[model samples]
Structure formats: structure tokens, C-alpha cells
Target: MTMHIDAGPRSSIALTGTEFAELDRLIFEDDDWWAMPSAEQAALRHRFITAAVAHHLEHNAAYRTFAESSGFTLADLGAPGSLVRVPQFPTRMFKRVEVRSVRAADCDVFKSSGTSGTQSMVWRDEPSLERLAGSLRPEGDIWRTLYGDVDLDDDGQMVHLGPNRREADGVWISYIMTLVEMFAATRSYVADGVLRLRDVVRDLEGALADGKFVCVAGPPVFMAELLRHMSDNGVKLSAGDRMAVITGGGWKKNESTKLDPDRLRSLAMDTFGLASAQQVRDVFNQVELNTAFIECEHHRKHVPPWVEVIVRDPRDLSPVPAGQVGLMSYLDPTARSYPCFLLAEDFGSAETDNCPCGRGGTTVHIDRRMRTSSHHGCALRLAETVRTD
Candidate 1:
């Protein structure tokens, strides 16, 4: 495959279209239940990650420097051994550094909301973004296996408490992707710097009044405020209606309000009239990682086979035993712009044993993020604004 290499800051190292198509086929294989055996999946992932590492080492200068500094060689990655040798960079590094394997002109620069301080720039080539879009091919099948046809139900309404994609910068892509996949009528309460609380309440109450299912989604802080308002205003919803409230990101802005998961679940049941606690689908995701660790009915966050999770000692970043919470790090081969190995700021425990849900993958439990990490971002700023009003 022919490629253009530049000598300047925009030095490029990206997979060709053909290479990306092949890699994507392996990474995003359509398996609804992800029922592949642990041993087979591990073997496949090992090969994929090794190839991914080699690709980055050859193409990405920043990743090569980081790997060499960490005492990793391409030869070392060639062996069939523990993946622990691969170096994982901190998530905060993205905020301060610009690392990519592709030229700036060839990428779509996605910026964070800058809720805390400065916005982070994450570059993605068209191929990576297209792969990301294709990765969800199994999502519909997985949702069907878990929540049944409810995800495909066209009668439901999608209510987003955050800003629309156009107004949210690039940080709201995940939210917008979810909204689009719902394939139902949708509305955003906060968009273009406007907070239509009354309009949201009217739509929500009207939907419930007509015996229609409503899917409420957004940041926990915003959802908490909506639920609190619904409860205080005595807006009753039908328990018989199919309702689900999915919350993501952290509760940093609502930390002062003490947003308890149990309390929120109770509020969802009491005010929004959700039928089960499982309907409150909390997820563990970050701007750095594309895959989301969605909580199942048992509240266990299952790590898909495409990536591996490691809990490391916070002091020295050494791998800790199962059940011991520490730094949450991931090795994802699907990421192409930069090194897929990432050390997140959060602390979480990992269980490799099979879950009761019959899915045999790494199950993670994130305790919380390290307090020392940076907090400036668009979501935090939006949360602060929403909370103040």
C-alpha cells in the first residue's frame, strides 16, 4: 500500500484503507452475545494487539518514543506472552499532548467540552470513525439479547438532557450516536446554549400520559435534576409503561448534591415509573476509550473480548490481584490514531471469572477517579451551568 510520510509536525502513520477494513472485520465481528470462549478470544486478541502494536511502532513516532522509553521493543512484542509488557499512557496525557499516527489534514479533530479547563483534541481518520460506526453492528443484537425488542421498539421516545451534537462540540458524539440508534423521535433539553426545562417536562409528561415508553438519557447530574424536578412537581408516570434511564460520564458537577445510585434508582422508580432497577443502565466509559462498559442486569460491567482490563497498583502501576481495586487501564487494539494502551485515572477491580449473566469476559467495578486528575471539561461546565439554574 502506498502512503505519504511528512517530515513536519503532521507526520503521518495510519493504516491503509484495505488494512483498516481487514482489522475492523476482526475487531468488530458481529457476535451478539460475544459468546466466544475465553481461551479462543484471548488468543485472537493477543495476535490482534501484537499486530496493532507493531503497526503503531512503525508508523506513530510518539508511540514509538513512548514504547522505547518504557523499554519495549518490536521484537519483544513479537513473542506470544503476557500483554503486560505493552506500555499504557495516562488519559491525561491526551489533554496535554498531541499524538497521532495520521496527518492533521487527513483527520477529523474532535475536541472535548472543556468543562474543567482546556478542551482535549482527539484526532480520528475517516477510516477509524467509520470503523467506530461499524463497531455498533452487534449492538442491536446485543440489546435484543439483553433488553429484548424494547431497544427496537419504535413507539418509544428518546429524551436527552444534554446539548445536541451540533451544540455539544465533538464530546457529545457518543450521546448523539445513542440517540440516533434509538430510531425514535428525539429531543434535547439543552442545545445551542438554551435550557428548555419546561419543554422537556411537557414532552416527558405528555409521553407518559399517552402511555408511551420514554428513554431518558444523558449525564447523571442532568438526569438527577430532571428526576428531582419530576418528583417535586408530582409528575406521575405509569409504572406499566416501558421506561429506561441511562446515565453516563461522572457526577463531578453533582457531587455536592450527593447523587446516590440507590437513591436515583428509587427516584426513577418512584417518579419516572421505571419498572426495574436494571433499567437504569449506568456505564463506565471515558473519552479515551471507544468501548463502553455497560452495566448488565446484575450491575456488573462486562469488558468485551476486543479489549483487556488490568487493575494496577496506583503507586507503581503494577498489576494487582483480582478483587483489589487500583488504577483502571485498558489495552484496546481497535484504536488506530494513537497507542491503544491507555492508563485511565479511575480505580476499579476486575473479575475474570464468568458472570451470572452467562457472559464470560472481564467484569469491572470502577470505584472512582483519582482526585488529583484534571477536572476541566465541557461536561463539567455544562453541569455547573445546569445546576446553577
Candidate 2:
């Protein structure tokens, strides 16, 4: 499904299905290399985000009212300066407002379990979900090619370190759960808030016994727990240069535990028997946005080509320089169902400086969730409940 862009005589811009398809194709089907033509990439993001802003202005009345009140309209988004002027709703507003571009009947509802036990509702129609899926498609197939393992197909092993899909509570968390489920031949959720070290290590042992490549993914805190257990029990396992631990959900749950990432990596290398630090990947994303910022070889979370990330001053919500730490907001053209340009509660730095990975996109360095916000959602709760010891 494509967006219905009304380009009347007075309309700022009208993009056809062909335009969307080309953008989708460019984003999904392209090869993953470091060299992205800077000029061409910028032009593509500007065109796509501008058209998306116009689409939201046309279809979402609440968004339109908010945009106009904030002194923005479809007419105001062509130039770079005006484009940044696109109004952003707070990410938490998704909880109280049902401001969707699609009709209620056409949308599928998803919920985010807040840290305080309240759930926030997110509505997405099929088309928007398709766009989200498209953004995620590229990373799903990486493991097969990681170790030159042609035999690794749907039958590959996936050891999940967090809640399973049945227990997943947010869009991004569920997205990762589904991706791991789809690509891995066999799957296991290591901990159900109760770390069963023996069972977890046994599954790892089975996956590696036959010289198979295994894709292990979950919140870093849980992975840390597993690493601690494996270290204590003297059970070091190996996949012979064919295993990877993809960590997500950050170290929020272990803030009290003081779980160090460097130590976690050290334990992972010894416990999982990964070839090198490159075999361990870190992912950055939140439920409010459609894209997942995967770490490159340099460990930079490069923003995908189709999305725009801006670092803003927390007090005034204005743009900051590349290196300065501030609130991280996103302008995502992929979501036609709701306002995708959202000011997140995350604190981070967005840099355009040359990365050793050679990828041409903003590299985001997330510091932590905003201390003032009460919306500590699913992953944090999962982390807090885990019985690490």
C-alpha cells in the first residue's frame, strides 16, 4: 500500500506511488557499503521527508492543527532551514493521543508497557507497518553472510536473551524478536526474568556442537547475566568463528548492577567464543521511530539513509552542533499512519563527522533516557526483573 498524496494546484508537493517505491527500493535493495554519495543521499532524504511532512499535514487533522499552530504548513518545508521547522510531537503523546493519519478501522493497535505499569497505545495501518518492515529487512539477512555460511538458512540457531515474542511489549522489541524468529532455524529465549544458566548454556552448546553458526541477541543486561554465569561455572563454549551476539535494549536494567560493556564484551569473547569484537553487534532504536540504527564495524550507530536524526537542545528543542549531547529527535518519512517526526526523550549526540566505517549517515551516540520522563517502557522493566545472580 502507498500513501495518498493530494497535490492540488496550491499543494506544495505531491509524490506518486512510483516515487515511494523507488525510495523503498533504494533503501531496501541496495548493497551495504561505506560509500554513499553525500550529495545524492542528502537530496533523497530531503525529498522523502518533505513529501512525508506534507502527507501528514494533509491527512492528520491533529497533526495539521499542531503544525499550523507551531507556524508550519506544507508550504514551509521545501528548503533545508524550513524543513527543520517541521513540528515534532513529544514521543509520550502517543500514549494519550490517537492522532493517526489513517482511519481507526484500518489501523492495527500495539501497546508499550510503561515503567510505571501503564501501557501506551500505538496505531499503525498495514501500509505503515510495511514501511517499518522494509526499513528492517536489510539487517535481517546479515548473519547468513557473516561467516560465509551458505548452509545457514531458516534452520540456523537463534538464542534470545530476553522475553520471547509472546512477552514482547513494544514495537521495536517485537520487531527484533520477529526478525530473530524469522531468520534463525531454531530459537530459544534464555531468561524469563529468571536466568536459567544451565538451560541457556545447554542450548548454546547444542547450537555449536555441530559446527553451526548461531545468532544470539537480547538486551545487553541479560547477556551480561549469561556471561557472568558462564564465567562462574567455567563453561566456555565456542562456535569456531561462527557465532555473534547482537546486543540491544542498552544497559539500562543493569545501571544498578553496574554492568560494564567492555567487561561484557570480554566475557562474551571468552564465553560465546566469538572470533573478535566485530562479531558482537550493538543496535540502537526506540519504539517511536521506524528505523533501527545498527552498529558498523567501528561501532557507530549509523542512521539509515531514509531517516533523519537531529540533536536538539533539551531546554528549547533547537538543533545543536554535531558533537554536542542533547535530545535526539527523528524525522522519519516511513510512517504515513502517524506523525513520524517525533522529539524523543532520549539524550544523544548526532555526528556527521567522518566515521572509520565510511558510511554516509549521521552516527548517533545515545547517552541515556531523559531522567525527567516517567515513560520507562518495556525493555527497562524486563531488565529490572531479571534474576541475574
Candidate 3:
């Protein structure tokens, strides 16, 4: 079967059928691809990113104009350092314009959760959606590494703290959370804009009694609220090492209810009777990017070999030294429906050192979102065109 489904304008610069199949095999089929040598991984990333950029430049008119204005040509992507020269649209651009390499009618649009009446709409075609589904499946090597000896398919149950998939159709985080249902039996606790805390407690208690492994996942804020509710009612379950708490989406804009990572993990451990901190792992992703960065046992969010992450100075968009906090940017080759190279409105740092968990690639550390007034560089310039165009 052809892995790529392109329903938009065809381009000669795009990856050919054979090339796409090879790339897909390396990423989704080859088990040892993540453990490859750093040099080899970099070479693969360079090749894939070059093709992806070329494809987008030919198919996306807005992106092409932006690249031309920035004086970034195909020649600029020759060196490893040249990856930074690729023109990047600010993630906010998605809110202002429909940035797509595929036909609007041929893609599913996912919207980010926002209260400001402006939400980012990300387009994902069939191939792009398939890549995402493959990345999040629990049978992958990364998932096995994080969840040793815990089988979710046979003896596990998922207790999600968000709405079901149908209720969260276009909402990105909730929709992603529900995707785990495909692997394990799942029950959602939030419905009709209310968290059914009693239902969650009852199911968790039942799982504890039955001795079945449980994977509880949702936004950190919702998880925190559940933890607090259990603590207040003195309802504790002895799930010791039989349960895992997976939190994602952060405590987005919930400043008053925010709990730092350490505090959140501590609460989960104490409330759920988990034996170690390793059972509480966090996941990181955004609507624009197709890949999800999952935390290993050592608490580092491992960046896969298929993507490149850079921390850039917010003022001038130059690359920052490793471990220095700045605006987070990404070169995501998996997103073929759009130019996934983005200058995001997030503040974070990244390091390429070998992690204690035996992962050899880069590990990203996200700090917080950049203030709206702090937007700069290509993002700011792109916003100017939003008014003129």
C-alpha cells in the first residue's frame, strides 16, 4: 500500500513514492532507528528536511513568498547549520491564515484550545495522520522503554480525565488523549463540561480491587484537581507500581491552578500509591507538530531522530547555546501537509547529551510560553504580512 496520500497539488520536489516508503520504514518500522549513531541520524534528518522544505516551498504560495523575502533558497539548506536559515512561520500564523500544503478539502483541521477567541487550526492529511497515529502507539520501542513490564494491551485499562473523542473532535489535546483508547479499554470522566470526579474515583478503586494496571492520563490541571479531590476525601488507592500517571498539555494559562512538574509528580505518587517517580511521566506536543516528545524514566523528554529542535534568541532569531532558554523552534519532517518548520511562542532549552536512560539524541526542556509582546524575528515580520495580504 502507498503510505503517502497526497490529495493536493503534486510537486516534483516532494518525496517520490519510493523515497516516502523508505523514510516511513526507517521511522515507523525499523525498531533500531532510534539507537542509531548521532552522525547517521543527522544525515537522515538533513535529507528528509531538505525534501520536506522543497515540497512546501513549491506547493505553499505563502510560504514560498516568505522564503523569497527572507533570501532563503534551496542552497541555504546545504550545511547542518543551514537548517536554521530555513524560513519559519510563527505558530500564530496559523490563527491568522490557513497555512497548508494540502488542499483544504482533503485535510482534517484540528483546533487548539483557547479562550481568547483565536485558535490555531492545523491541517493533517491522511499520511500525516497516519504518522501521528504510529508515533503514539504504545507498542513502540520508546513506549516499551518507558513502560517496562507493564502491558497495556492485555491487562491494562485507561482512565482518561478528559471528554471522549466524539466530544473533543476538533480540540487537539483531548483528541490526542483519547487516541489511547484504540490500544486499551478506556473510560472518560469529563462530560458536559464537568469532571465526573466520583466516576473517576469509583473506576480507579475498582481497578485497584481487580489488580489490573491502569494508565491515567489527561491535562496536568485536571489531574491535579483529581489528586486534590482524593486527598481531601482521604480516598487513596494502593496501586503501587501497577499504575502510571501520564500528564500532558501542561497547565495551559491556568496560572492560579498551576502546579510545577515536581509538585505534580509528588501529588500523583502520594495519591495513587505509586512506588516511584518514574511512574509519573509527562508528554509534550503542539497542534502544529506531528511528533510527540515522551518522557523517559529519567524525566527527560527525548526528541526522536526524525525531528530537529533549536532554541533561538527571541530578539534576533539566532541559535542559542545548548541549555540556554529561548524561543523554541522545530524542523518536523513528518508533517507533509504543511511546513512544520515553526518558530513557536514557547520558551525552552535543549541539550544533545546522552541521557541517563540510554537515549542518545536531544532532550528538550520546556519552560513556559513566551509573552505575546515578546514575539520577534520572522514571526513578527510574518504578522506584518497578515495585515497587508
| Residue ranges of candidate 2 with Cα displaced over 4 Å | 1-16, 138-151, 169-172, 190-196, 253-255, 385-389
lDDT measured at residue 10 in model 3 versus the true structure, 0 to 100: 58
Best-to-worst TM-score order: 3, 2, 1
RMSD of model 3, in Å? 7.1
Choose the strongest candidate by TM-score.
3
Give a tens-digit lDDT track for model 3, residues 1-389. 11233334653233565556667887677764468877777778888888888888888877888899988899988887678888888988877777778777768889775534456778888788878766776766766754577667778889998879887767777777887786578998767667788889999999878878888987777787789889888988788888888987755443664468999998888889899999998888888888888888889998877788989999999999999999999998888788899999889999886688776788999988866743222221222222110
Put down candidate 2 lDDT per residue, 1-389, tens digits, no spaces: 22232222322223356557767776567655225676666777888888787777777777887887987767776576455787998887776676677666666767664654345566677667776766545343333235454455643677777666555544456446456565556454534556566777888888678666787888776787788788788888766577877887656643575556667777788777777877787777666676677776666777777777888998887899888999989998887677788888888898774687556667888887777555555555566666753
Q: Each candidate: how many clashes?
A: 9, 3, 0
For model 1, the superposed segments whose C-alpha errors exceed 4 Å read: 1-23, 26-29, 79-81, 114-118, 133-142, 151-153, 172-183, 209-211, 239-241, 253-255, 373-378, 387-389
Candidate 2 global Cα RMSD: 4.9
lDDT, candidate 2, residue 313? 95
Off by over 4 Å in 3: 1-18, 252-255, 373-389
| lDDT at residue 48 of model 2 (Cα atoms) | 83
True-structure RMSD, every candidate: 4.2, 4.9, 7.1
* CA lDDT for candidate 3: 0.77
Ranking by lDDT: 3, 2, 1
- Which candidate would rank higher by TM-score, 2 or 3? 3
Best candidate (score: lDDT): 3
